[model samples]
Structures are given as C-alpha cells and as structure tokens.
Target: MTSTLALDGIKAKQQKTWASGDYGAVAALIHPMAELLVQSADLSYGARVLDVAAGTGNASLAAARCGCDVLATDYVPALLDRATDRAMAERLPLSIQEADAEALPFGDGEFDAVLSVVGVMFAPHQEVAAAELARVCRPGGTVALANWAPDGFIGGLFKTIGRHVPPPPGISPPPLWGSPDRLRELLGGSFELTITPRDFVFRFASAAGLADFFKEHYGPTLKAFEALGDNGKALYDDIVALADSSNVATDGTLKVPSRYVEVVGIRR
Candidate 1:
C-alpha cells in the first residue's frame, strides 16, 4: 500500500500539473465522447449527477443539458473555473467545485449518477478513486466512464512523455483503467458494468500542428515537454513521429483514431 503522505504528494503535483495549461482547449476535441457517455448513462430528469475530475465540465455540461443536476469537480480549481464559465454561458444546471477524486466530499449515495470521462482514471490512487466513484452513487444508479485504452494514441502519447520525463515510481498508470479486467477488479463489487470499446478520432490540420496544439494547450503534455528541458526537441520529434505514424488522413490533415472504453455501470 502506498503511504498516505506519498499519495497526498502525488495528488498535489497532479493538481499543479493540470492547472498549468489551458485544458479546456485540449478537451474541446474530445467533447463528443462526453455526449456519448451521458447518453448511455440513462439519467432521468432531475437526477443528481456528479462529474469527478471533470476537466472543464464536458460530462457535467452534457448531463446538465439532459436536465440532470450536474456538479463538475476537480482538484484543480483553475480548471473548474473554465467549466463554471461555460456553465454560466450555456445556462446549464452545471455547478463547479474543487474536489479530489480519491476522497470526494459528497455523502455516500448522494448522486443518482456519477461520471468521469477521461477524468478519474488519472488519479494516482486508482483504487481509492474507484471506490469514491462507487460510494457517491445511489443504489441502482449509473456510473459512467470513458477511459483511454492503453493501445490508443493518448496512451502512446503518455508513454512517449514518460520515456522522456518518467513519472513517480509508485503511481499506477492511468491507462490501466482502460482495461475491462482492471475495471472489474476495481469496480465490479459495487456495480454491474457494461463495457464497450470505442474510438475517438482526433482531427487536426497536420501531424506537426496536432503536436504543437497539445504541447501548448494540454497541461500534462505541456508540463512533460517543459520537464524535458534541453532534451525537449526529442520529445517534440517523438510526438510528431507518433502522430505521423498513426496518421489515417490522406489530404494533408491529421486523423488519428484513439481507442477508449465506454462504461455504463449500474450500482448494485
């Protein structure tokens, strides 16, 4: 077991990393995944929903648009600031707050549906985050997730970043949540889950363009590249190479299909 102190340190660093760049800009390309997730959650009107580790309220806003009362939470309040701005502009029933995925402040069974779209999977203490996700949902309620698969572009991107700036020794890789077997081990006790493999295609003008976008707007990617220091060119070249190798577009544009697992679990 990881010491509480170690976990806390990891969480603190995560908050800072996420707060660094404009994640809202990066999340925009993947916003459709949130719509797909909310559609499968089977949420009823007036249902209380919690979006854990919500980066700029994609899932929360989607749920809110369906008439569900949605609260978007993340440890990094600065990121939630963007979510709050969007919620206000859209007039959706989406509220924003700073909350940790591993130790959510809400009461057990407080929400009718709990969600995290490419969110809580980033929690270093995966087990604790999974437990909190289950704990906050009412019996028979829904718990939906969209996790990037290990074999996908996002996973490969992380791996590329790790090769340059390795992560802490004990943190569980976020992509583990992409596997059905791992999901079962972590969440099956509390929910009856339906898992489906899906792809989220990323579109950009060019491979180099996509790499630049991520390096500029994605916090984790930005930080990873920054950490590379004098070796930053290697990371840039690798990111470009990864995108170039996976490019499915033919007309001088970038089209990479990243796989993710969409899960809709019923609270048991």
Candidate 2:
C-alpha cells in the first residue's frame, strides 16, 4: 500500500461530496443493479453479507430480502438513515454501520460475501478500497460489484463535470473499476474475476428534467453545481445537452441507456 498522506486529504473531500445532497433519491433509480449484483454473487440463504459503501442499502436490502444476514455500511450518515428507514418499512433485518470503504471496521474473513454497487469505486484510493473488500471476505467467498463503464452515460457525465471543476490530482478515476484490465491489476492476486457488460436505462420526462433531478438530488451533481456558483447554469446546460444527444426514446420521453460492468470475484 502507498503512503496514506495524500489519500487522507482526498478521503476527507470525498466524504463531504457524498454527504452534500439527498443521494437516496438518485440511488433509487439504480436499485435494480443491486438485485443483479446479489444474483451474480450467488449468495445463499442465511449467508453473512457485507455491503460496503452501501448507498441507501440497495444491495443490502436485496441480500436481506433473500434471507441473507446483511450488514450495510456507508460513510454518509444521511444515506444510512434512509437505508435504515427502508429496511424498517420492509421489515428486513439489516444492520447499518458508518464506515469508510478504504478502512472497513470489521474482522478479516468475517463475511460470506462482500458487495458494492456503484459504491466503493468512488473511494479516493482505489487499491486500498479494493484490498479492504477482499480482506473482509472469507476464503472462497464472493465479492461482487456493479460499476459504471467509462464509455457510458454516467461516466460521460462525470467527465463533463470534471471539465467544469477538475478533481484533485493523483486520484484514479472511479470508472476505472468498470475496466476488466484494471480489476485484474487491482484484485487478481486475491480473487478470480468475471466481468459482464450490462445496461441500465434512465427514464425521464426530458433531458432538462434529467439534469434538474440530478442537480437537486445527486450529491456529487449537487455539489458540482454549488462549486460552479455563477457558472452553474453553464454546467447544467452541458449536462442537459449531453442527455439530449444520448436520448434513445422514440416517443419523446427520455430513455438514456447507461452501460455498466457487473463484476464477480471469487476469493482465491
């Protein structure tokens, strides 16, 4: 592992970024990916599962619904609160913990499966986060992920945001988690990786609606606009234009397909 000095700063900023807005609303749209990840992991009934960086308990809820014992964690307290509410309403047994992906507070080999759906990839130190995921799972257990492909709509959205307000230097792009080559480099020594490409379509009334919804609900998007201040409108315009160009709906309603890669890694 590299020195933690540089990552310390990035980690702090990352926490604030995620905690800035009501991410639960934005996360709701991607909950389906969580079900897919749970299925890909092949979790068995009553298995002990850990959902790291578990935004709004998407994967955690899915696993719990399958009769698995699940512990969902996130650094942002608000997100965990939302997850807790969801679990209560569904009468599902889920334990919510406040934890950082790069430094999980759990015993080694403590879980039957570890999962992250578009979650852990945002950690400031990618390798450290990946190592933590592997460390927490028992030997022969599974680690499953649903990450946005760099060539996809969501990935392109981030790139557009970067043009407006560049991210800190020396941090790996979160979308790298979607790349099979990067996964091999990050996780090969500890696990055997299988990647499957998939698409998740975002339906909205229009391009403007999509952009407005994200600006109001997605933490990173909300924060990006805040940081832009006077230039926020310009950023919003770019996002809407991008969405408009990518809309595939023939009936006028927006249906934007975002490509992502589902990763299943069996511990070596």
**What do the candidate models score in CA lDDT, each in turn?**
0.91, 0.92
Colliding residue pairs in candidate 1: none
Cα error, candidate 1, residue 105 (Å):
0.9
The candidate 2 region of ten consecutive residues with least summed lDDT is: 1-10
Q: Which lDDT tens digits does candidate 2 get at residues 1-268?
A: 4458878877877788888777888788899999988988889999999999998999999999999999999998888999999999999999999999988999999999999999999998888899999999999999999999898999999999999999887878899888889988988889998989999999999999999999988878898999989889999999999999889999989999998999999998
- Per-residue accuracy of model 1 over 55-105 as CA lDDT, tens digit each: 899999999999998889998887788898888899776778788898899
Clashes within 3 Å, all models in order:
0, 0
Which segments of model 1 are wrong by more than 4 Å?
Answer: none
Task: Pick the TM-score winner.
Answer: 1
Clashing pairs in 2: none
Best candidate according to lDDT: 2
